[model samples]
Target: MSGPTRRPTLRDVAGRAGVSTSTASLVFSGKGPVAPATADRVRAAAAELGFSGPDPLATSLRQGRVGTVAVVVEAPLREAFRDPFALAVLDGLADELEAADRTMLLVAQPADDPVRAVAQLSSQAVDAGVFPLCGIRDNPVVEHLAGRGVPLVGSGSPDGPGMAHVRTDEEAAIGLTTQHVLGLGHTRVAHVSMNLGLRSPTRAARPDDLEAALYLDAAGRLRGFRALAGDAAPVAVAADLTVGSGEEAGRLLLDVPADRRPTAVVCQSDLLAAGVVRAAWALGLRVPQDVSVTGFDGVDLPWLDATLTTVLQPGVEKGRALGRLVRRALEGEPVADVGFPVSLRVGTTTAPPPA
Candidate 1:
């Protein structure tokens, strides 16, 4: 064996193309002026030699910056991305990062063991970090990244000094739908909440539940709903953000005698609202006629027949906002917290309670 086959390098491509190695680098980096034909020749040679261009590690070292940003999500990748809103936010963040010539390094931190993320990130190098979604109120990663002098951005969780955020008034945002259903004369309204933290079961939420809530977004929205719906209102917490969890929460609240059932169900997310709608149908209940349903996060649900009444939060825009903040921080600009606004969208799913 001749010391294993050597991998093709930029020099190999440049030599094959009869050009300087610097010219080959310029072609890949898309910097500096080069003639069209010369660029074509280098590309052709690269193809012929199976050269994939410059090494990112070497380039980053030369630039004095890693072209990667750590995007911290609260759930497992499969579970976190299941929501369309989450996917949209990721898309927007990816778009903006691409514009800045940066890449996203996804880091999923389970709520049960948030410090695990700190450990995972200890060995990784990133120019910055982001909490792109709701997470625990007090994340250990915040302290870890802060100590490393890495700039941090978030959308309203893991709050601490020096971390810029695209903050949403969660209480006011949830109030949009809560007030909508209340305005529709649905007095016996029930609430379906996303899990307060990891391993939360699908069951009624007690007053003490809010005290122990790790997810601030869920807690804030719950408080908003309670403000309008009252302390004694029937509230169910989903085991997770999934439709299955929502459906289970729905059954717990809706699978009861008509007189005892809530006239409207205000859910914390469109996915959960859709699940509640499905559960209603399963219980032989007609939406609006029997129970009005409203949700937060006005995500598109094409499969559901009735459009949901929800808080119109533009997920992609929020993600872009988070990305822009990161870009500013990385560029040595003084970044500040940004306020993201939301609106209430009324849909056919919500109507006045039945006679």
Candidate 2:
């Protein structure tokens, strides 16, 4: 008895169907114009030979395309999607990717052990990789995936060769609000920061934290804040992006003696700013009258009653920029870094120091 029957190949079908190999290939790939009768003959031969088009793996290996992109998010999906800004960015990215006839494979990198993501992604055959947001400056996955010759794109950080970025000047972006409050004559100012270091807790920022910070955006913003607010100005870091974390940070800076309390608070995100507003209300402080607050990312907060003085960086547009970069990189185009623009929008939340 025979060990097994030989598997079918496209060439076998082409030979049996009495058609040129290229014509048979066109019938399967749908890339070129083929006569209906000839296409029917190829399909009939394929059916007779128990063939079902080409093996996807063999096709991809030949074409250097998996037709899928790995979207790496440094936080768990549950935690990452909680932030509206993050959701908007993801939405825009999804839209652009769908239009390109590409599929997105979201890879959530654990906050505690990012290296685990490299292990998980090693088995996946992706055409490209995307960080897509401001995340850890030094990521292990960057080197691992780059070694496999996958093109990479992101908004900031996890930077390296074979990677294109949609750049944002985080320091200058943070300064837009920092300067706004300073211009308003608020001397006793404070800041609420997102996590400066990975897997860190909510607390006051320390010198050690600044040096060891892996999140490039947060570090840049802190540096920008320190540049204007002096080295000794107070900074309370949030545990995460939630309003609760923001509130905790807010109370740290605001729950103090009238003389010691900051007259103004500048937060890193709109969610944090909203929390600060809540914290101020709990402490019986009138916003913009007793204590002014400002936030970054002018994301829409429909439930919040007050407007935030924030840096207007459109998350959707930023995501689209990242997608566009990825598209260009995949098309064998010479990729270069593209700058993403942001502007300041003043609102109801900021004012001069209370006399």
Per-candidate TM-scores read: 0.89, 0.91
Candidate 1: regions farther than 4 A off: 1-28, 34-54
**How well does candidate 1 score on lDDT at residue 319?**
93
Could you give candidate 1's per-residue lDDT for residues 223-263 as a string of tens digits?
99999899989999999888888889989999998888999
Task: In model 2, state the lDDT of residue 14.
Answer: 97
Error of 1 at 177 (Å): 1.1
lDDT of 1 at 12: 91
RMSD of each: 3.0, 2.4
Q: Which ten residues in a row have the lowest lDDT in candidate 1?
A: 197-206
RMSD of 2: 2.4
Any idea how many clashes model 2 has? 0
lDDT of residue 5 for candidate 1 = 75
lDDT of candidate 2? Answer: 0.90
